[model samples]
Target chain A: MALDYALLVLAAPASGHSSLTAVRFARALLARGHSLQRVFFLDNGTLTGLAAAVTPQDEHSPLQQWAQLAEEHQTELILCISSALKRGLLDSTEATRHERPGATVHPAFELGGLGLLVEAAQTADRLVTFG
Target chain B: MTAAARKSILVVSRHAHPGSSLPRSALDTALAAAAFDQPVALLFQGEGVLQLLSEQDSRAAGVRNLRKVLDSLPLYEIETLHVDAAAAAAFGLDRDALPAGAEWLDAAGIRALLARHDHVLGF
Candidate 1:
């Protein structure tokens, strides 16, 4: 039977290794013919979708890769807005609220709440998390 | 009802035996979810490999053997069990040393397996 998958990427780029691990897992999951319904970013994982950072030439940027994946796969990338805000990640609305210079939200991502997490759990055939 | 329609949870905990409150919390959550007839799968990762070691004595920690609790998982019908391959290797644990029926998975495999469950709770 076909399965709809919800993946939680919970590790930050600054964290040891979870971000890369999550990307590899997400790629492999799609390759194996599973359906990815949503990709919810929480805690440090939200950093994977930040749009303002400039990546050094030698480093692999998770944000760019995830953005491309979202566009190609049409996966809903949800950034936990509360967690992002607390961590200093601001969307256009938030950037306006705080009068920040640049918007942190990426085009491929949407600011959301815990309701997205609950919805992913309640709706997906499977919920997988990488942290 | 479809499995997707029912409430189910998969817990991935990678702490040692008699380790900390985290593993216990994961177990408690799994047990509670199972009690509600929600299918639960407990996947052990990292140091959580120690959890499957037989003859655990939690009395030193003023606790009961967690293995004992895990053994009763079948009674709750929470039978999907998984252990991380790298964790077992890190601890120098042989495959045969784990609980008889638990599936051993590599990192990538574990990732895919997790994607096959309804909900994932980790500690």
Candidate 2:
């Protein structure tokens, strides 16, 4: 069966294995013909969308990897609005609204409300949260 | 959505406060689901039972007090609060030290609770 899965990312890119594991799981599931409904980032997981994150030359950039995955899979990448704001992961509109210096959110991701996660939980065949 | 139409969501909080913020997020998720008209249940298991201890002050620590959030669960219509009996006992918490209205569950009861839910989000 081609199950539709929604992933909740709760771990930061550099903190633990959850983010990388989620990326790998997404790739694997998509390859198996499963549909990824959305990838919702919460808590420190919102840090994965940092626009200015610099990766070591020897290491793969999780930010770019996530961006590429969303682009290729047409997957919705959402960051929790409160969590993003707390971590300063803002989009252009949010930055302007808050009169911040600049937007730090990447183009691939959008800031969203908790309602989106609630909806995803209701609609997706499976909701997997990685933290 | 009506009661029958909504998905039954179980938010499993398994961590202690002050050490990690995930416990707060788990409660937030439950409240959000309840606000969205989904059937929501919150379970405090493992080290998560530590959150049930009354009067934890985090004002000086500069972090949001999770008890404030937990106290608000009923206002959101999330009355299905659960606590693992073993976890609570392991933490040496008397029943009075915990909040009122929480149903204490044994291991099998917890298993049944998970089985009945449409979705389980663990933290």
Candidate 3:
């Protein structure tokens, strides 16, 4: 039977190479005909969804890339709501909570809690983390 | 058995190398498990403590600093965060340097904690 996988991206953008590696791995998993149930962004990895920041010309922005992949593949992009909120990452709900002017969450992303993590582990055939 | 009674997971991360991808990956797994309502614990060992160090700037490299994600742990309902006391001291890290509410544990404590978990992932 084909395997269903969950890819966890945890490296901070500048701290390490996990984001890029994860993207590659996700692509590979898809190419192999495996199903990607979700991409869970945690800790520094959550920054992968912030599209507002200006990236340099030379650098590869994992956030933008992941967002595009998630959109194209219909992969679930989940940003830990607690982590996102504390870091000033507001979804529509959060923008209203702090009376922010607008939502910081991108289109391909959703704010979620820990329960999503559990579901990924229980439901997927393999839980692959890129840390 | 009920889903809630399933095995707990332990993730041990010891590196926070500049531009390394493991930290974010580890965090992703932890958050995903927590989001799924699975029991998960994150343990910081060795150089991994640097991940919690405050005021990191990834702008020079055109990246978002990851400290923001660490700040979001409680929001994900992933409250069982831990750091090795000896490792923290060896790295000259103090409580203030980490996110608020992170627990400090010694090697023995961490080992005991690991024993209780059903799975352990080291990065």
Q: How well is candidate 2 docked (DockQ)?
A: 0.75
Please give, for residues A7-78, the per-residue lDDT of candidate 1 as tens digits.
Answer: 877678756767767777778888889888789887567777677767777877778878877888898999
Per-model B-chain TM-score: 0.86, 0.93, 0.91
Candidates sorted by DockQ, best first: 2, 3, 1
lDDT-best of 1 and 2: 2
Clashes of each: 3, 0, 37
lDDT of 1 by residue, B3-112 (tens): 54775567888777575645765676567556655667889988888888876777878876888887788888777578888888888887776666688888798888
For each candidate, give the interface RMSD after superposing the true interface residues on Cα: 5.3, 1.3, 4.6
TM-score of each: 0.57, 0.95, 0.61
**CA displacement after TM-score superposition, residue A30 of candidate 2 (Å):** 1.1
Candidate 2 lDDT tens digits, B27-109: 87888888787888989999999998887998888888887777777888876569999999998988876766688999999
Candidate 2 matches the true fold with a TM-score of 0.95
Clashing pairs in 1: A126-B117, B14-B48, B15-B48
Candidate 3, residues A87-110: lDDT per residue as tens digits? 777888788879999887777889
Candidate 3 per-residue lDDT, tens place, B1-123, comes to 376557677888887845666676578667777766678889999889888888788888775577788888889887767999888888888677788868899878988998887666666
Top candidate on DockQ is 2
| lDDT digits (tens) for residues A39-70 of candidate 2 | 99988899999999998999878899999999
C-alpha positional error of residue B20 in candidate 1 after TM-score superposition, expressed in Å: 14
